[model samples]
Target: MDFLRWTLIFLVLALVSAALGFGGFAADFAYIGKILFFIFLVLFIVGLIFGRGRGRTL
Candidate 1:
């Protein structure tokens, strides 16, 4: 959850920086955002696969 949030923040920052003409900062932020997104995606998939059998009792 936190990871996703940061990824979004970075992406937004990247866009804003690019609009402001801060090419270097924008590129760096974009790269970081992309990496974070991939990490979050992998974690989500892993959770789905491994965290699926521990809920509720009838």
Candidate 2:
């Protein structure tokens, strides 16, 4: 949940930075967004892996 929140924040920051022509800031936020996205992806995959073993799948 926290990761998703930060990811969304960084994504919005990246977009705003890009629109404002803050290339460095945009890149930084983009990088952060990518990291957070991957973190969420991994968590999701892990959840799926464990989820399938249980009767309740998310």
The TM-scores of all predictions, comma-separated, are 0.89, 0.84
As a TM-score, model 1 comes out at: 0.89
What's the lDDT for residue 40 in model 2?
91
Model 2 score (lDDT): 0.93
- Residue pairs clashing in model 2 are none
Candidate 1 all-Cα RMSD: 1.5
Instruction: Tell how far residue 27 is off in model 1, in angstroms.
Output: 0.3
How far is 9's C-alpha from truth in model 2 (Å)?
A: 1.0
Candidate 2, residue 35: CA error in Å? 0.6
- Candidate 2 segments exceeding 4 Å error: none
- lDDT to native, each model: 0.97, 0.93
